[model samples]
Target: MRHAGPKLLTQIAAVHFVSHVHIMLIPALLPVLPGLLGVGFIELGVALAVFNIISALVQAPLGYAVDHYGARRVLKAGLLLGSLSFLLLAASPGYALLLVTMALAGLANGVYHPADYALLAKGIEPGRLGRSFSLHTFAGFLGSAVTPAIFLGIAAVLGTRAALAAGAVFGAAALLLISIPGSGVYRVAEVGNKGCAGPVPATGRVRLFTPMIGVLTVLFILLNLSTSAIEKFSVAALVQGQGLTLTWANTGLTAFLLCSAAGVLCGGALADRTRRHGLVAAMAFALAAALTALVALGVLWDWALVGVLGAIGLLTGIIAPSRDMLVKAAAPPGAEGKTFGLVSTGFNIGGAIGPVVFGWLLDRGLPSGVFVASVVFMVLTVGLTLAQEVFMARKGRGALRYQR
Candidate 1:
């Protein structure tokens, strides 16, 4: 059992790493794609939009599928589907074809969260689950971090098509890794689903729609909204509002992202040590909110700004393992897929809405508003986290009294 946990974690993390690589492929190659497809930026933008919309629409339903059909089966299908989409793109480089391929890719993208989380929940030992989740997340972040440089370098030397072909190969390799005998994926799934009969009952389905899940969904949305502001707009804000050089602003953003990844690892250790995930998340967000507000003030030295952003990144990253732990704690048994799926949809929702709002502020020359808005979202998240803790505590007490 102990050996099985680490093996499963390693394989699942590799799968997650490839999943993120696929997600970033389009954005990474955007510069060359317009010219390659003989299309303008608007056409490309529409393709990207199509991808996000399809992903958002299907995520919840897919979560149910993961729970019903088994995570292993659904995940394999997603891997194959996503790989084929990219291979198709490499084969046919036309605007119309791009839209079709991206839509396919989007549906494939929706498969990762529910399937990955479901697998981890069932496979890893309880004591090690927090660290497993963090490592999995860290792998994805590493994928995104490396994609731009690796793919662009490939595109530069071998052309766009070859770069995409490389991604397809990566995905195919991941598929084989999971499918092979002795991978332990099959063993984990069998153990996890033991004693489960046909389909999930209506009662089980109802559990997914509870207020706890809804609040967690909102919490996920706020988390994404807060981070997106800093990630998508902070560099612009710092350069324009804080009078920093473009180089310095980008440097700060890099620090934030790198530290955020480092923080996830540290946060994993913290998560394993404590059950007060909500307190951890709430405190981290509260402190992060304060630091973000400081950035909005635009009064710090350039180096100071970089340091503050790095600090905020560490705080944000620290909350992530705890955030996943909170969701896991709230999830009803046998419903991990649906719960994770439903809450993860919040990422798409926030991703879709956040840019318009922050871009609007930037368009209107309210650069500082970007940081200010992030602060607002972080504060809201803290409130939500605390409220959830209260609710869960009350529910626990009620159950104890009923038992008595």
Candidate 2:
């Protein structure tokens, strides 16, 4: 089958990957902050929250601008500001300065999602959206996942702040790369309708696809919460709860990430071809729940528990791209800003909530709580999936009647 404009997908994937790397820089770089600047968890967490809050605040505007304008102008400027923020964040003199830099990074991140999603939703064939988004999100996952190795190596050779400075430099390099000759140039504004480079014909109606987008937004948040908990507690569970060495714990986390990335590709490929995305996404959720419970059960039978937990990572990965596909399919015209921004808000909110809530559970002698909570979150997605189906069915019928 012919792919939907391979060049465009490559362009979007590159930006998506960079956006994720910028997101991952925090947890990777946070430890050095305290040793270098003499701050506490409270201060660090507060700064992190400030960054997220700022991103959340600007996302709506960013999405709106992208809808009105196009991805090229918005993406370039956001990336430039984000790169600057990374540099400033790495070298900030005080905690206050760091927070300000993070806030700017937040704003920068805000500008990418809406226009990017709109482009994919409009330009790519509907049948291929799953695989495309999966590939896109996987690039992001790979970028974020590999950063520690890159950052740590740089830190070992050039010191911590310099290592982070390197990340900023790399980000800026991505910006420059996009500007070169034959780099998939985007028109600032197209001459005749299609609202600027969109694949959809100008006459296509948009209201036919809104409510389903809303349902998936709910799923995005809930599923993100489970993934955030895994990131926060996976290593802790292995090291602290199971008494494995930190190195071993970290190794297990790597295994999980690798498997998860593979799962993303597999799931996206499957969803792109089949109407069973909901079922597949649901099953992934259930598997994640089961594996988390197995860990809580403590029937490890040796390192097998670690192995099974890696599978859980894979399940969430699958769920992620499937969720992305649902949103893309439901992405109506003229509302990319409202829809993508709302979903992104849900994601950021969940990211902020997961660590705090799961940390509390861990502190309170509740190993099972994490597993239980993840299971509950996944179960909730089942309801959201059903709601999406009903909404889509209704929309499809409305379209049929209109056609008749």
Candidate 3:
């Protein structure tokens, strides 16, 4: 089992990496896609929006499928479907086809969180689960970080179609790796009650809609909303609001992203050492909120802005593992798929909303509002985290009393 643990983690993490790469592929090649498809940028944007909307809508139902059908099987099918979507795009490039392929990819994209978390919950040992989850998240961040440079470079040298084909190949390679005979992927549906930390109700279906899960869903939304603001608009905020040059603004954003990735590894270790995952998340969010507020003040020097953004990134990244751990704790034994799926939808929701809100702020000549709004989301997330901890504690005590 010990030997199998790392192998399983590696395979699943690779698939997650591929998923992120696929998610970013079209966006990375946006410069050339509009020309190739003979469509305006608006159409391409709509395609991207279609991808996100479909992913958000389908994720919860797909989670149920992951629990009913085996996770490994569902995950493999997702990989195949995602890969084929890109392959078909590469083979037949047109405006309508692009939309169709992106929608297909979106449905395929919805499978990752539910299927991936379900497999990890069932396959990994409890002792190292936090680290496993962190590594998985780090892999995704790495993929998203690198996709633009790698795929754009491919497009520059070869063509946009070639880049799409390369992405398909990447997914296919991940699929093949996990589908191997001794890959250690979980082969059975996880319907047993062994994985739940607290007393599970008789009707497992109710677990997906519990108040704790509702809190988690909201937490996920606020978390993503905060981070998405930083990721999408911080550079603009620094440039426009603080009068920093574009180069320096971009430099600060890069620092934030890189430090956030490093923080995830550190966070995994911290999550393993303590069971107070909610407290860890709350503290991280609090510090992050404070830093973001300072950034919003627009009083820092350019170098100081970079440093502050880096600190914010590290603090926010530190929250990821603990955040996932909290969700894992809240999930009922066999309902990890639906629970994670339901919560993960919040990411898409937050992702969709953050850009529009921040973009509006920027359009209104309120660049500082980007950081200010992010701070607001972060503080709300801190409160939500503490509230969730209280709820979980009360629920645990009630379960203990019932057992006694």
Candidate 4:
């Protein structure tokens, strides 16, 4: 088989990038949602939780769909439903309609990772898969960073309704681009018209659910929950609980996200350089945990807060590619979609719970609990990473050796 082309990478990355943008649109729009939806902050949080919970329930099935049917069909449907959800939002109906909208979006969002990763695995050269995975992750993070600017920036001038319309248009445009016949993602999907790739040698049907995969899944959950805690609650925690100004708090959050994107790039190069991805992830988590504990202690004030947040972001971001490498290393043969699908569910599970938990802490007048929770989760992730390393070693199926 020929090496996969750059077009495949771009197409898959584009799908990931667009899906993240849609996922983040709610957060960016949350400030104004209460006014529009006639609900309180907690109600808004519930809506977000509904989206995530639904996503968690469906992702594993979508993984099976990707293997049994085809990623192209699922991906195309995801893009369409994702767009429709925003259009429904633009319509600004009642709370019931909003819940339905989120459910549709959540179901659609679940298909992306399974589909995109499956496509990349089938298309990319083995030697370059790590970098491809990094680029894919980087695109998603970039999408997260940009969503606020796109949505809020537009809503500031135009109405929020117009902003939602624009988001819908964005998804529609992506769907059209990927649908084009000569495009890289399209060509690959066309190879198996039914959308399912031809059969490869089968491992056990349940092999994808190994203990190492479970550890990796938990690691993903902890990572997402920790990030969600920081992103959702840190600013308010700092301002209300720690006596920091809103400006400084927002600056810290921005530095964390921007530095994280930068770290993905660095991690991509580093992923290619070493096979000890488990060690790399462990070290990164340990440092991030320590820094987060400092944040929880309020040891850093003003400029120092921004500096510490940036450092934490960099350390955590650097682990991402290595983290992906570890999961790939643990997958049984021909189980790429199943493994990624299962592990990715951890993100939704965390997303489903993180906001409610952290928001409750803030509501109960426990701002310090936000950062404290982040540190605890990060520390737990470090333990899991080490355990995963030991498990893989004992199985004699070490990290990065399974790439082929």
Per-prediction TM-score to the true structure, in the order listed: 0.95, 0.88, 0.94, 0.92
**lDDT per residue (tens digit) for residues 84-200 in model 1:** 999998987788988998899999999999899988887788898889889988999889889999999999999999998889999999999999887767666432254643444
Report clash pairs, candidate 4: 70-195
Per-residue alpha-carbon lDDT of candidate 3 for residues 93-114, written as tens digits (9 for 90 to 100): 9989898998999999999999
Say which prediction, candidate 2 or candidate 3, comes out ahead on TM-score: 3
Candidate 4 lDDT, 67-176, residue by residue in tens: 66667877888899999998987887567777887888889899998888877877777678778888999999998889988899888888778887888888898798
TM-score of 2: 0.88
Q: Give the CA lDDT, 0 to 100, for residue 158 in model 3.
A: 93
- In model 1, what are the clashing residue pairs, if there are any? none
Candidate 4 similarity to native, TM-score:
0.92
- Model 2: residue 196 alpha-carbon error in angstroms: 4.3
Off by over 4 Å in 3: 1-3, 186-206, 398-404
Error of 4 at 317 (Å): 0.6
Question: What is the alpha-carbon lDDT for the whole of candidate 2?
Answer: 0.72
Worst 10 residues of 2 by lDDT: 185-194
* Local distance difference test scores for all models: 0.88, 0.72, 0.88, 0.83
Tell me the deviation in Å of residue 292 in model 4.
1.4
Per model, how many backbone clashes are there? 0, 0, 0, 1
Runs of candidate 2 with Cα error greater than 4 angstroms are 1-4, 90-92, 185-211, 242-248, 394-404
